[model samples]
Target: MDFALSQEQQMMQRLMRDICSDYGLEYWREKDEAKEFPHEIWDDLTEAGFTGLTIPEKYGGEGLGMEEIVAVGLALGRHGGGVSGPNMLTLGPVFGGISLTEHGNEDQKERWLPEIVDGAIVSLGLTEPDAGLDTAGIKTTAEKDGDEYVLNGTKIWTTGAHVSDYIVTLARTSPMEEGSRHQGISLFVVPSDADGITTNKIDKLSMRCLGSCEVVFDDVRVSEANLLGDEDSGFYHVLGTLNTERIIWSAIPLSAGELALDLAVDYAKEREAFERPIGKNQGVQFPLAESKMELETAKLMIYKAASLYDSGEDCSMEANAAKFIAARAGSNACDRAIQVHGGMGFADEYHVERLYRDVRLARVAPVSDELVKSFVSTNVLDLPRSY
Candidate 1:
């Protein structure tokens, strides 16, 4: 099987790399420190058409697929934006936009898809304060009221909510039936400025520029026309998008690991220890070498998952495996880079500290590593369900 990127993929990578170069590590550092969104970078990417790689051509997007999106995500992450840069592309276009493209009706798609292609921020409101990863456990309710639905609930970790023009929220439309906790949930395209909807920004250790928030919907009104996909089938619709998310999440950490490895290697070459460069010492060399090997291995899984997704094959196993492997590899690589840098690594000047903070999220968010293990054990191994 051919593993090399095609000419078009290579061009996409180069374009993203060049755009990222204009912003650079210093730009990310400033944005992170200020707890501000990368508006300039966002505008640049949207203007250049990188934000809508997965969107269809009819929607004013590039009409690319998972493989192309993966290429852009890797280049953006590797160039020092950490998870923040790639997230901007994925959360809006790949995650929320893809959901709408697949499930949204003609009117919904006509109204929203073009906006997404033009760089509209679409936040996801799936994780509730109590639900966490158990999406079916969400307490948010959307009760039908004539031509509109009245929503009431709170969603935490709603990324980009403060700046989002629209939030693709999941709420319970009917009571859970026996033996099916996933049923009765539905998706809604709630306008961020809807009445009775309140958003409070959440402070966090990493990805500060992305602006995670707690969104409270107190009798918020949404028209029936805003419902996405079939009623009570939101769980299945979300599941479909999640497979794609896992692949992109895997790429985030994989690229971060690449950046960490690059920093460690460059430092090892220049920093002297015991009258010789650190590269001469096996103590330093081995960890970096191991990280490189792990990253390379994880990257193969990422490509496999993306390819399977693009080919319309069953990629749940590969997607989960890629995320599980890449998260650890990326986190380990960043940790090793910190050790290699000694005291300087702890300081933000070297930028390894930021990478450390950003890559660590891969192990937790979207899906935890432990959960991925459980999924693989049960789903792929034909073992009994654990949770």
Candidate 2:
């Protein structure tokens, strides 16, 4: 019931903000223009032990909870420069949540968990060219051949694929049943340099600076040791993992909206229009007011869901709602920011354009707003499934 950050959490947020401040908006804009990943900032994060905020301390991580993770992520988004700053820490937990903590064997955890905590990038490759959101429809297959499994398929939107050493991917090991598409899917830890494995970098509308790509698997082979969970049960495992991903993805918008609102507020106070400060105008004031209200609530929703998840509760509905609310608020904030800035918002030099585009992905990536409404309607309201 109490919704407040503890002193320690506040301190953590301050530390994150300080680190992020070192990399200013101009630093991010320069990287964005070149379409390059922030390696130096990433090194600082890794060195600061922020990358593994949720992993166990035994594995050289910070051994924290989802609240701490959210704090760090929010700080990165609001102050750590931009959305790309938080992207560095997203993949490892994304892979670890499903493959290591939930399903990996002791040996697997020892090997992968430490590396992930140490800031070794580990991406999740689930979305395929044909799968879209229908993950069970994946045609990527991994067949058992003695001690090895041969994989052949292409994965689209494989974020961090270009630089990551390993990615836990989903593929089919057994043939699907006559009518059941969800069955027969399995997960594997695939090396980026495995034979016949190649990546095609993608140019996207936004979040392009985050470094996602299309990874093609052409008869890439891996040892049986790479398998995650039981072979046929990978589909279920992926679903559970996705729930966590949805929660984190949802918070991204909250952070973005907060940052956008802050920038807009600053611009409104300083920018003069019609011989008066824009902040004095009702048009600018109302939208900023609305965005501020939305941002606070969105942040609370994100934190509530994150806290619920750390307690091992079913948070699917809350997570979806968080994503939905945060994305809308973030997008709205960016739009208001554009209106507030008048012309400067459109230019990359101002950086509101970047935040605007980045926030759009929260609505589309992982889940659409329409789909989230469908879920809430059916699950929470006892309505029939619309989709």
Q: Per-model C-alpha lDDT, please?
A: 0.90, 0.82
Candidate 1 wrongly placed segments (more than 4 Å):
none
Model 2: number of backbone collisions? 0
lDDT of 1 by residue, 1-387 (tens): 999999999999999989988988899999999999898999888898877777888888887888888889999999977778888876578766788888999899889988888888888898987779989899999999999999999999988899888999999999998899999999999999999999999999999999999999999999999999999989998887888888999999889889888989999999997899988999999999999999999989999999998888999999999999999999999999999999999999899999999889999989998899999999999899999
Predicted model with the maximum TM-score: 1
Residue 259 lDDT in candidate 2: 80
> TM-scores across all candidates?
0.98, 0.96
Candidate 2 ranges beyond 4 A from true positions: none
Error of 1 at 11 (Å): 0.1
lDDT of 2 by residue, 48-166 (tens): 88877777777787777777777888888888355676666677766664357778888887888888777788788999888787788899999899999999999998888898879
